[model samples]
Target: MKIEVSLLAGQQLKASFADHEIISDQSISAGGNAEHPEPFDYFLSSMPMCAAFYMRKFCQQRDIETTGLSFTQEVITLDESNPYKKKVSMKVTLPTDFPKKYEKAILAAANTCTVKKVIQATPEFEVELVK
Candidate 1:
């Protein structure tokens, strides 16, 4: 899918893709109104959201109750200025009634998230000046 990104006023930006639009802006301190989350925030969140959806779908397909299922994601960086050194940690919180036998299966399901796989594959990117 091709996504078109355009600059708006000041530090605000808009991304338009098939049937959807997302707006992003810098923090107020960074000279934007902070109308929405920054672009990096969306990128950072996409992985965990994708993983959680996979976990939930796995539980649902197996008729497992997801009432208490939850997850937390943490990002660690050895140096704040170094994005390449970042490490992401994701934790799965199982419900009280979750079966012990399916523990590994559930983890495997979450690990199958497409977003995580894409990052691991290190897809190449290209940019062009469109006059």
Candidate 2:
């Protein structure tokens, strides 16, 4: 999967991934001129979505019935000196009727989620300037 982001102006960017598109703007407190989701929100979203995706697949395979699911994340930036470094904590909520017996199974599945694994492993990236 590939995503592309183009700068529009003044802390606003247009992002596209396949059929989806979004505009990301930095927070006013962060010196952005527009009101839109910031990059941090998008990073937070990826973790939960990854877990949800795998949870659905796991439930299907185990014949589990899920009426609803939701997740909340708390990201703590430990060092103001390094804004990019942070810790993410997630709380996953399943339906009330979800079987208790499968709790471990579901958790195991969540652990296997691609984004979760990536976060845990702390993947490396290479940055370069292209003209």
Number of the predicted model whose TM-score against the real structure is largest: 1
True-structure RMSD, every candidate: 1.4, 2.4
Clashes of 2: 0
Return the lDDT, model 1, position 55: 91
lDDT of 1 by residue, 1-131 (tens): 99989999989999999999999999999999998999989998998899889999999899999999887898889787886699899999999989999999999998998999998999998978878
Q: So what's the TM-score on candidate 2?
A: 0.80
Where does candidate 2 stray beyond 4 Å?
79-85
Per-residue lDDT of 1-131 in model 2, one digit per residue for the tens?
89898988889998899999989899888889758889868777888788888888988997877677666678889899999888878777888998988888887877777877876788999989999
Pairs of residues clashing in candidate 1: none
